[model samples]
Target chain A: MWSINYYGNWIMHNIEITDLKRLTQLVKDNHGYDFTNYAMSSFRRRVNRILDLYNFSSVNGLIEKINTRPAFVEEVVNEITVNVTEMFRDPSFWREVRDHIIPNILLNHQSVNVWHAGCSSGEEVFSMAILLREMGIEGKVKLIATDLDNSILDKAKKATIPVKNMELNEKNYIRFQGSETLSKYYKEENGVAVLDPTLIENVSFRKHDLVRGGIFNKFDLVLCRNVMIYFNQNLQNEVLKKLHESLFKYGYLIIGSKESLIWCEIANKFIVVNNEEKIYKKIRD
Target chain B: MKKRSIRRSGIKYCKVVGDLGMSKYKLDNTYRAIVLGGSAGSFQGITKILSSIPDSFELPIIMCLHRLKHVRNGFVEALSIKSTKPVTEPYDKEKLKKGKVYLAPSNYHLCVELGNSFSLSTEEMVNNSRPSIDITLETAAYSYKKRLIGILLSGANKDGALGMKAIKDNGGLTIVQDPNECMIKTMPESALQATTIDHVLKVTEIIEFLIELDKNYK
Candidate 1:
């Protein structure tokens, strides 16, 4: 009953709900990572993908490996946390940030603090840095980017991307209407796009878990876009509260276009800045 | 070719074939949702199917149509213009309603999670599709099991084939548009090849089947 056929050749086992619960418990007990709060269906999809990738026939095999190998847990963590992102995703949102939000923040403070929570391989951080540089305000902005996976954080620090992905990133940059071409920010070498090191000179990339990590500092703006969609409601409420605490009073928070804050615990504290782009301004602490 | 002839002859022909083909299966009013997956050349057929169904149709229609990743607007509005039920792109975690149409938003994998809500993902594209038909159908099958009805339409890719198979494996009813009638035969043909589909239907017959199913709800 567990085996199902796809593509006529492979008989993939369906990871049942009970198996998923067992796997989550095993990961929590063996490693310190807790995946219980992650949305079950999507998490199950990722775990299934891991099984297919590693050619494991059953969840028990994955659990046995986790029990034996200490280092393999990092790989599991990296795969579990999706890192799909692009530079200047939703260009109109970036335009709003460049024209309205950033300038508005600068009027009050000499320097602005920005946090890219779940930065995910640094695309958003680099995009923001490039934007700041374009406005001649790179020196006035402090950026801290963090993700749960240290492996991806290292890539974010390195600032290199596959050349194949640059076409879409450049297209997004054009749509954002940056002053200079996106080509000015990166060099193509050995089939990879090596972004200018200076693009992240002001960015501090760190390994921070949004679920487990404490509010380390207040921010003028926090971009936690697309990160909370993976969590169930209770976990989303917990993480939203942590994010609300991480922001300064009246600071802006931008989530993914499809994500909403209306159902969260702190819904009353944030007023909609732009509903279409999912931007909100904190009205109270 | 005309609507009059289709209503006159097509409906009768389809009813007889449907009765014979589906005699083993019973419509026990257990179906929770209808999932439609298509890509490339499916818009017209989907519009036809949506427009033909009455607003009184009770089950929610979840769609995973491949679309432009960056162009986020107008698609749903365009689909809504002809649809009897209001077509929308559901926000992540939005609950599935009884008589609405939910389209998978561009550049995200739409999953039908347990507890009757949606969850979106930005995982790498499967079969080069972010709004992957397989992901949506598989997850819907996971949630609805035997209560799910999956319909596959015309497309150039083989994405929906495995999804149709998944639905069949979950004891759900499966239908695919007749390959000969499809603008692109690859999709429905692949589905036909992948699993033992309950029906291989023309667009008009598919509409008749749905209208009949809706009557059971009333």
Candidate 2:
């Protein structure tokens, strides 16, 4: 291990195989961004990508660079926590959310509290909003859309998407059997699709890290699609535990179509409402 | 060897070119995966290669092939007929194992997810193909690094060239099928031009090389 001076501070610079936990700890300590709970394989892969992208000598050099350049931390956080999602991502999953889960959630409560955790860029949040509006329950919902990456949250908050993305969005809308033409929800001008601002009237966008953020509020429906697959099993279990705690008793949880809760300890705590679409209902106490 | 005996056969084999260097093909201790990619006139070559592998071959072989989007079934089943190792389309989040051949499911780009399992994505097609050869190869290179083996076979497009180069850049072994011996030389020709490939062998030699690699790893 060697030492180096960068930006008038002695940053630890070494060529050894730096411990990933140590790196994340350094980030947590210096930047207050916690990543220790992430799966190491992906954590390591992203670090390696950063090393390649920036031509860092090693993980130490990467950390040293991060220590010196405060602005780079945002880039790192954005890349690491990034989950690319699409509107109506899985057509059938949205169908189930509309037909099966939403009705069940509305059965026990006057309104629905839908939490879109790790809601990258708010695609899923918009999907849920469309469903709620179509179901005539838009006025009776509180939707909290949260992610660790604030830049993405900002984009989601704006709720406007590029016009080109409308092709697949419209395709999915049709596949989902949405009540109205997909164009009725958004106006296109100057090559941009402007969603109705009212779509997000009840939606709140916030920055929240699923890895460390504990339970804060209860939700009748929690849609955390396609995010946990990025996490290792232990972290998945921990986050699922946290999500389980955040749900109202017998509240519905709809995961990504590809994500499975089969091996999670909470698997027994939820009944499989629809396994293919990955919708589960909390077991009543 | 006759190529016409295979299905959709447009395969034509020329002379097996220059000798494969034994030293450079070394399978080191860290090696863990064997990723093979191909398109357009690849079935014959892939079948021949898979059929030639010894029963003792134990690497987790992942294959990405560019077929028409409408190919719903039988691609893996066809390969399993000739593969001594079992071949099956991978389910989402399916765990990896040795001595198995995993096919990238249609309409999805396959990625090596965090848990050493496979994840499928319907993200927009890349290089005009859903099961983009480059996406799978690049992700495998990232996950396995120096422990990866990426082999690009015959095709009509330039999908796997950059990805095979990525494997080489990451210290993983890189192999490309001999362009002169392929039915459609565009893919292999592109890959050969992309990076300093370690091996450029014919279908049979590639198969034997894989068997040898398995032995070396053990």
Candidate 3:
């Protein structure tokens, strides 16, 4: 099936193996989003989604537009990053970290440094702060939260949450054995919950790209939840290596409930602390 | 070797110019096997039939269900809750086993070639689908030639009809859900007209027939 390719979009009856190779090249050359080892099905759907949104009559047209417009490429790349997250997302996972992972850190390390990579909009940072405070470990914890999106970081710094999300947020918070209602954490006015400044006193929000580099020395815990699923396997493995290097000896790494280190080259470096919660503890080399 | 012939007949062949380095397997006449393809309104009927079959039932059931891309990982959980037999999404290179049902994940084509082992490919969208009904049924017909039972259930397209006909031509059983009984009848109706279907039954009767076949044959 012969086809014309412009920026990885092919106009053909079937997706040729040659087309995939060309797509890989185009992504690298133009967008810098190397999708070479991403699951093929996932890569196809994302391309299709982009085509639909752009309202291109065919893949050819979409490619033409993308080749001509750099902003379009940026939008498409952002769309591909699935950044869906929630506050204190999995309560059980947080509980496991608090009970099992944190105590081990307290034993060897008098002070702790934590990095929450891909920390979208700071709900999770606040949640982590609350956890540390409740444990009387807040003073000992230093957190540096970063994500690729500066807009999200701005929102995170503001600590303002949409009013509608508060009800469910409160429910999830209480389910996590929160001693006080979520309403107590933020005063409601003008349809926004301005998070208490105290929760983020030791926390710093920055624009850090996982695909690029994070400028932090060492940390006890790296809580990167629900952010890697959208990453191509190569990117996932690369990011995992960076996280592995960043963790202090015997430090912890936590991923999404569904995410795993099984397929990574560094899978043997960490022992699973809680498999279902996806909490892993770094072991000595 | 003619492009015109392929375009006219709706069947195209790409002669392997060189070895693609894929391992090949061969099998002789296999035992009775069921291959099912459905989408759109497939979940209810498929879950019911799959969940009703016992683990003791001695046949392999390969199912393809269409799903929205990147859906949560509760399909096995849901199907396991509903099915009497164990339902699992196939891991890459996992060997095929009997008495267990395999469900294709949201966005991949699931095919069974010779040797009864399943293969997943992301080559292209067939009939506008990744987990295409036609791809699954067609590959099974190519492999199981005579022992296959191809079933077309509730779906919104004509994906399985041509593949179902291939199964019948290979001396295998071709079944379709009675159009009236199907939540979406276009696919079942397509199969009935395009192929020599051996049976057209309601979902309940299909389950009963499977049970009876398992009891008598196995």
Candidate 4:
């Protein structure tokens, strides 16, 4: 195995492409978690991080752990998937949603159906909830949030975030120009900001793997921001198709500000509503 | 776009001759990509380098520069104002093309994948930087191997030191902005200590070198 000395202290074993294929195949066969479709570079980096975090000597060592302990697969899955997210990330996108997209959605539909695909730790779902509440349409929207990792989905259900992250979230909220201060929505308890439970009360949190899961319901707006960045072209096309199918005809699809649908199979079906914020309107069934 | 196809042919030729080892090439037309890493005081230097390069420069230029995590919109536009070639922040999995410039997006760690595409991560910050110079440089080193040109510029910290070392170790050409001329020498000085850099050029000299390299492609 090839290794590199990080800071001349710890040697990081380079997780080769062949090793990734082996690990992904093993996970697919044994645990039924399909990670083969993940973008190889980022997935390999995450696996490399796991090796260092757990002090595994090599990829084989990680494989050994996966083989011996059935419960360890959950831990591996958690580590493999990235969960870094914040409230009101890319605040301009949120602003565009409030000023234009929501009003546009409400014009045709009395009640909006929203899906927060890959909602990590619930910041974004809560952000949407708060936005709907401030618009006085909280009761008029049905929200469903899903993630690949059950642990993170549980955290999302909890609606609590560390106090340290609140400052950045608050800054983002201000930039988003919300109806009220972000603090008005959450309470501080023992160094964690506990969001108002009412905000997420109607929201259903589920463990849905975008790669393997089927489309359960059609939505008026689907926010799968920053999630598809982890997927390869084949998986992205597949997921985009599922996302497209999950949306009602002419419904809105808002992705991360930097994410694009231009290169995907579904590109021709969606009209670019707001290019800078990456808001799209599905034009074709 | 035609330039890109030509560059692609160059890449295929490089691969055919690659097993013979890269050190023998000496910055010939074999290089496929150019990666640059900078921090604190490097923006001016980088902009100067970017603005100076001709529009005909064919190598894909990938940059990892430290910027505020929350503030995202202005950097690319600012870089584009004077750059001859358009500057862009590539979306995740976007393929790298010749004759284009790519900046690491804010709040994301930009990585160069083996397939000549970008893979971004929300992974924890390395050396307190989201677009960690080390990650970009190391990954670029791995992907491009000897066909990469890595340049370290002025910065307050040592984020790019290990990256420069990686580029050097992978038989890629390594360059650092001259410490004496840098606004803040910590970054280049750190790289100088970390590895044997190929050229320690001033900003103008770096621009000239790039122009000369572009002429070779012509």
Candidate 5:
């Protein structure tokens, strides 16, 4: 870990360290967002990128501009927490979920609660909803979409996607062999597809921090995909335990395709389901 | 792309000596192993070729790369999006199992020891990088011997040559990225100089070779 040294008060200017400290402090103070635990190297990269973009010679100059201009702060925060995702990002994984995993859950449980822990911008939540609806268990399902970013969550609540993304997502949906046409799920207005509000009715889009504990009740399936990869192993294990506690006996846990339970202390507890897809079914005595 | 037969280089010692003999029996029947090495500009290409392999591939793969120190982001996650095979950075004392990929962790040199077990060391950086291609290839040469297949991919420095030589010295197969096709040719070029490279192919052709090797042996 590279630690940036701070000289007491004001001695001279080490603009890089100063900018990182100032922005980090600002995030904590303004939004109660603590990015302090994030990997220092990645944090430094984003900090330097923002500093270069604004061409600020000093951290104080950047601070003054951000305090005066809220949009600049928003951009900085947004840059630090970029979430890139797509609908049914891995079609094969989703296929496993839709074909092999969901049927078992339906067979075992009368009702299911699926949690998308880091449900950034809601593409996956909708995808999950579509999966349940296709299985004829839409009404019996409750999907909780959660993210730390309220702004992104607010955008997700609207369920309106860009015209370009909708076209691409339509193609993706078709490739995944979704039973319904993409147009059936949403109405278009001026090239944008406004997703049907009915689809997310049972789905609650809320601001929940994974770092904070014990919000949702026990869930039958938890799809926390591609989110834990950013966390260190300690955090990954911590979150896995929390997710484990949130799962009912014999519940299912699915992770990103690359992520696995092997070597994890929790591996003994879950039976592997399509290890390549990283789908696991919780097995408890 | 040449019809010329590329024969294995050097004097063929008629007698496979000691552990090499044992390893020859173990791997003489096996021709598939996943090999990964990287430097700058490797993200997209690595993922593309890896994902092109089948998810159910039965051979073990070893991957080495230079990672920026102290980044917690999942290099495996980004690559997994492009690969059908499951990817993971190896843990200390993790047994070298088949059908999985083991990546070198950041700031660590990942190597294989005897008995198909992995060893990680934070020893002084080689070639100015902890995940030096030389360290991995050297260790693999000692462990897998002829069972190994080494790949030298995009890199800014000549780090993999000594390691590639180790692989060659142990009678392992070697492949170098075509200098004209590599994103960074230095690493592959160095390996080409250090040993008699068996294949100098594009990324796509390498993928095809791997698939063919996987099918042919397993």
Candidate 6:
């Protein structure tokens, strides 16, 4: 029930932490997906939104669906995942990846292994692919793009973004000072811009939940930009450890320009290679 | 109001029943949060409203003010000066406090998540704005329910319209600054047209109502 304490009257939501745990348990029991480690704040917001969208009477109603209709899990996955991305989002960040990180990666290995974790809708992945092609290393790269949602993975595989978004994407590309226009990598058709299939030939799109997934492979660089902000510190540490273990010695790790590794358990393992670009280098094994 | 064809998804959520005035509105200090949204010409309106709040008032106030996406704005510093209460840009996962004003950080969509804490999203721009009022209000209304007091002030676009609806639908108080008094009237007018507002007051009256409303809990 609602109560007033040091602050004025604080309204306690009918749904409590216990309910969330029960719901997480229910999902894990049924679908084998663990949301227990995911950021609960955003998780609850998404749950309420899904409840509204599906017109479920309560959180209990949503739970009922989880127990019975396994097919509805796809929809739940799509809605819950925050898939915000753009083609060269934060131009300066990409500029650093192109100028410094890529060159650094080349100095260490002939064929670079790049992991784009939480690659929502594949915008960042495709942008990086274009960068690789520009740097003349597209043939030597093994890129894997992964996210928790299968539906978004399908969209990423298609590599088509809205035509209207291309203008902003183009602006970002120019600001990033790409060798050529962003249009060189994609074909525009019917208000949609589709990326060249060849660019994604080396990239594998997979459904991998960072919160629950294990280490899939070692990489020369990992780009988990703009994803962990949805997570809490504990989860960030958990996932950051996974990233740390996945990187080779002196490899690169790039996060969103706004995201940080400060206070994270593995923070000391990484040193900021480029502070403004938010690119870090793994100094130790 | 033209098309009252507003979407109300579930009774589990919120719905604004009717347009209300200051006298018609009832306040018993049950409000845990007061959310205000504004855009163009809002800096002045926000200052006036925050300056009017008394030192003893004790509700956590949140604001989503639209700004240049890339500009490093002194918005928090400026607002902190105008407000009697402590104001700062909340760090990720910072607990929402009483008698404090939290401004949305630049380029981040600020959401009030399930806990009494703020969540930041680098999500796509909504209505061409990063700190979209609709997104913030929807998130806060979902969390706070009827305990929220959402105000849509001066803005250029229709950003806060549906957000005001979200608050009203969940049985929270919804107010819009009178469009006539707004420097840029589209935002408030947009809110008015979409949802029948609860309190259509001038900035001065809004501050007065809020101060008196805070006394309910005191």
Residue A200, candidate 4: Cα error in Å is: 1.0
What is the i-RMS of every prediction?
5.1, 11.4, 9.9, 4.9, 13.0, 10.7
lDDT of 4 by residue, A28-135 (tens): 998979999898778877888789878898899999998999789899999888888899999999989999999998988899999999998888999999999999
| TM-score to native of every candidate shown | 0.94, 0.78, 0.62, 0.91, 0.56, 0.78
**Least accurate stretch of 10 residues (summed lDDT) in model 4 chain A?**
A1-10
lDDT per residue for candidate 1 within A165-191, as digits (tens), equals 999999999999999999999999999
Tell me the whole-model lDDT of each prediction, alpha carbons only: 0.88, 0.76, 0.70, 0.87, 0.70, 0.80
What is the C-alpha lDDT profile of model 3 across A145-213, one tens digit per residue? 998765667778888888876775776687687766777778887998888888897688887777766
Q: Check candidate 3 and list the clashing pairs.
A: B51-B83, B51-B84
TM-score of chain A of 6: 0.91
Chain A TM-scores for all candidates read 0.95, 0.88, 0.81, 0.96, 0.82, 0.91
Q: Give each prediction's root-mean-square deviation over alpha carbons.
A: 4.0, 7.6, 11.1, 7.3, 13.1, 8.9
Which candidate leads in lDDT? 1
Candidate 2 lDDT over B34-94, as tens digits, reads: 8999998888999888888886788889999997553456777888998887888776567
* lDDT (Cα, tens digit) per residue for candidate 3, span B100-208: 7887765556766345555554434556665777667766776677888888899897777777887887788887886777888988888888778877767875775
Candidate 4 iRMSD, 1 decimal = 4.9
Worst 10 residues of 2 chain B by lDDT: B7-16
* Candidate 5 structure quality by residue, lDDT tens digits, B1-218: 23322311211231234225322112344644556687876666688778888776777888888887434357767777678877888754467777897788765667665556555544335677766677777767766778788887888887778778878877888887777777788888888877888777678767756765665555
Per residue, candidate 5 scores C-alpha lDDT tens digits across A1-285 of 011111111112233444566676786787566665543333443454455556666667777887888667666656565455667766767778888877888887787788899888888888887877887889888888888877888878888787767765776687678888878888889877788898888778888778655556888889987666444455667778888888998888988654667757787889987776778888873
Q: Give the residue spans of candidate 3 off by over 4 A.
A: A1-24, A187-194, A212-216, A232-235, B1-48, B51-84, B88-201, B206-218
The predicted structure with the larger TM-score, 5 or 6, is: 6
Kindly report the docking quality category of candidate 5: incorrect
Model 2, residue pairs in steric clash: none
Residue B194: error of model 4 in Å? 3.0
What is the DockQ for all candidates, taken in turn? Answer: 0.48, 0.17, 0.08, 0.35, 0.04, 0.18
Per-residue lDDT tens digits for candidate 2, residues A12-112, read 22222346777888889888788876644445545654665566767877778787897788888876764556788778778888887778777777888
The better-scoring model by lDDT among 1 and 3 is 1
